[model samples]
Target chain A: MTSRAHIAEVFMRGLYPVLIIASFWMLLRGHNAPGGGFIAGLMAVAASSAYALIFNSSKASKKMPLLPARLSVSGVLVALASGLPAVFQGLPYLSHPWWTLSLGGFKLSLSTVMLFDLGVYLAVWGAIGGICLHLIETIEENL
Target chain B: MILPVAPLLVPLGTSLLCTLTSNSVQLQRKISLLGSLLLLGTAIVLGVQVADHQSISLASGSWPLPFGIEVVVDRLGALLVFVAALMVLICTLWQMGDVDPAHSSFFYPLLHGLVAGSCAAFIAADLFNLYVWFEVALICSLGLLAQGGTLKHLDATLKYFALNLVGTLLLLTAVALLYGATGHLNFNALAMSVQYVNPAIMQAVTGLLILAFLVKAAAFPFFAWLPASYHTLPAPSLALFSALLSKIGICALIRTLSSIFHPSPEPLLSMLGIIAVLSMIVGVLGAAYHWDLRRILAFHSISQVGYMLLAMALSTRAGDAAAIFFALHHSLVKAGLFLCAAMIFKLSGHYDLRKVGGLYAEKPGLAAIFLLLALSLVGIPPFSGFWGKYLIVRECLVQGEYLWAFLALLVGALTFYSMMKIWLEAFWKPHPSAGWQAAKIVKPIPVTTGLCLLSVIILAIGLFPEPLIGFVNDAANHLRGHAP
Candidate 1:
């Protein structure tokens, strides 16, 4: 409505994507350090919270309808799938075996741990984001 | 090793898959039914494993015992998993007829979620893991209860949520305190660790845990949440809830009491006995008073659970075996009865016993199925409930606890009275509405077929109690041998 308000909204909008990117950064760094999927999920949700304040939930939801439910379902599958390779290998579920690939003297390392973290990230993102959006929508409906 | 987790995986994966495919309710229904079949297959595989090896335990993350989550399928857990699968499969079959796709997009997912939680709880080998599974079951139950979205449903869900939340919090706090005091969460390891801990702290933790389990089990004084919420559920959901939900709590109590607190501390055993007696009396009386078919069954659930707890309170080998058999018998017969009730509703358009009748003449086949299930529930001869009651009464008599023994028989008689009340009112009496005969449903073979299959299973278990009794006795021994 006012110039200052408009300026603040624009600034917050720019910070939103940065926060989204940082959530992934945190998720990636979580394996060996202080951050992980649950915290990363909070960060991602923080961006959405900002967006909900700036805009309206109907618009936000229209931009990505059914996103929350999909993320949650797919996240669960991803997580469940990550545990299967080990079970097939005659080890316990979620044993987190690792693998490495060499491409022209460059090595890429991977582990079930990261896949699991990704699943957790998506699941937490969806659950928390969906809850916030639902709450906001309910309030709007009541008003 | 794989089999230990397979049962949990099937249901969990199926639940999430159902969620992923929620857009097409018909497709979701098919997927979920397939999931139940898969779960039953997994349960069979795991059952054979448990039969051969006695117990299969897996430590998540490949960590050693006491360091990671332990998932174990002993004979009792394996058997319960088998029944849980059977109940879900049957309920899914019956619910497919009733659920409207448009409003029930989330039903399949929630149903599977509930089953997954119960399966996980059944097989969990450690305290914290059991708590997690219980929470999962609790959450899914709340979702399923609120699915109808009526004012009564919200009211019921709130009652359930409020009370169960307290129980859950107590369970968590108890687990934390146990971990803090004993430095172990694995049942086997904790059994060893508790030896060096102060008896007072151990007693406090055990009391809290038992109280939490009682609340979950719908045992006396803490059982108001059950009838308050359960009558609000649709018949299929009610059938599933009656079959699996409270039984998990009973299973948990039997496990925790036998494995960790066997040779239970002073006062707890008597306390359990008191709770059991009160639950039986109160539940049967309440069932007699309620006319709604679902509420009657719900109250009967509390009473039947009391029988299992009564067996547990006996603390003898025979007592433990009776408890396990009683649980198995109760799940099968209760689910069958609720399905029969659903069919009656379909035919007569009512759940109130006072309002509906002439079912015996309208559908003789359904009448027979209902009669068999009700007879089983009342513990008549040559039915599954007969064996459960026989074992408990025998154990009580053998133990020379005449008061409990007398009360057990008295409660059985009262149960028969209430069940016969349902029979006379719902099946025997003339239809109150003049046109009730016009609305009779002859199709929906799945409901009757499921009930018939269930009755046959109950009859088979009754006729050949030797094998199941043997299996349950083996499980009872396994529980005792868990303690260091």
Candidate 2:
């Protein structure tokens, strides 16, 4: 039988990655329907916060020492990338195409604009959560 | 084929470069300077184009108009963006070595992003597009405000966010309703169809839209969040926030008010005029009451905005022109003054007027800078501030707006009084016990030479107002449906 602490560790270890995956899914699907960058980022950060609470802050820091900022910048890049083609074509920024994807027995349509939303989600989650954790650590050190 | 998207790219690209590199503070400073220099160049070229052409719109993918998102640039938009860029550039220089290294590192990117967002907002043609750019600019300001993450900063940032959130939601609802009522999102398109819409619904949207902008600009009843939270921000952040972020609301208000709600027989014009006068009185009073230098300046920002609103409310060609000209003037002067105030705080490690003394005795250059900026603020002759007032009073008189003219003069006098208080206490007073000991200070008095130099530029603009004013007049005329 798994001990209580072991079960807890398993839960702790698995939780963030699962949350990250869920967040990515949400962001990707958010374009036409719902679940855009803002919500997904919040969810991803919530998972990160939970992980920090259960595991040692250090471990969580190690695993995700530099987030939010990193993600936010990447998200901006994703947005710019999607938007650049339009600019090169002599169009306004962020006025580009919607994307679509297909796999066996399933078809999905994707928007580059949706990718932009996902980028925002990742960026916010990473930047805000990372910064908050870092600040908390600083306060903890003083304490 | 239309508006140059390059100004937005120039900043966004620079932000990306700065954020990705882990660099020394000095390196970051250089990056900011370089980026701003490029932006200044880009702004100049774009300004020329915009001045000549009047208005230009760009749609991505060569998409046809009315079917695609468009970036539209007019003379007023170009002028404000250029002013914002220049002030940020100068403020960056003044802040060198004063702010924390980590803060400095991120400051450039955030600053540029704010510029990009502001530029985008100025030129955006669609309502939803305006909303997105507004959020982008707001986030940039919020990020700067949240620097160092002190309890005070967090609280202020939260309050700012909450007010802006509610304001934005209301704005979004108005946008949705506007689209539903007219099946149009473009400003020009909406303007054409607005006459067909029911008056009641149009008035409702106008009220909601104006409320959103008023809250952002901190006019009258919406002014509380500004003073309460703005004082807590670091000087550099505050300088930018007070100068650039506030103007976004003014621009949006001017853009929408004239285009969408013009000629409406609603009684709201008088209400706006009353709010303008009240904001001037209350803001000046708040300044008179505050001994904290930053708080004083923050209060004056509210007062300055009132004059702009007063001009807009006059609903005359000259009034509109004067308001636009003054908006540009205020952006430059206010940014310079805040930079000067930040320099003072940096030098003394105190924001209280009571504690500050003998700055002129110690730092002659800084005192001179303060004097020049204060002169500009108080509407002294041969300065940009004076020309702004001259234009407004002249326009008000021409329009038979004698009451507004009187209020303008009153506000100017009160502004002079408040500014003189800072001048006397900080620059003229005898050194009190334990007065400014420059040698014992932790950080060297952050050199405001760059910002002072920028003030000189404003003086230049004031002295030689032909080119800029010509451009502004062109914009004003364009808005009035005249030839550029």
Q: What is the TM-score of each candidate against the true structure?
A: 0.95, 0.83
Best by DockQ: 1
lDDT of 2 by residue, B1-484 (tens): 3246666777787787678764666666777788888888877878888876877767755567676777777888788878877866766765664532225467778887888888788878788889898999989888877876889989988998888888789889989988888898888788788889999998888878888888888899788778878778766667777777778888888877776566644477778888889998999999999999889998999999999888888776667777888888888788777767766776676789998777887778878877888888788887888888888888889878799899999999999999999999987886565634743434444444566566788789778877767777677777666311
Pick out the ten consecutive residues of candidate 1 chain B with the lowest summed lDDT: B95-104
Interface RMSD of each: 1.1, 3.6
RMSD values, in order shown: 2.4, 5.0
User: What tens-digit string does per-residue lDDT give for candidate 1 at B1-484?
Assistant: 4778887888988899888888887788789889989899988888888889979899977998789899989999899999989988887777656421115788888888899999999999899989999999999999999998989999999999999998999999999999999888899898778878888888888999999999999999899899999877776688789888888898899888888866678588889999999999999999989999988988999999899999999887789999999999999999888777877777777889988998888778888888888899888888999999999999999988899989989988999998898889888889887765636453466665667779889989978889999999889998988442
On the 0 to 100 scale, the lDDT of residue B327 in model 2 is 88
lDDT for B278 in candidate 2 is 92
Model 2 error, position B56 (Å): 1.8
Report the error of model 1 at residue B482, Å. 7.3
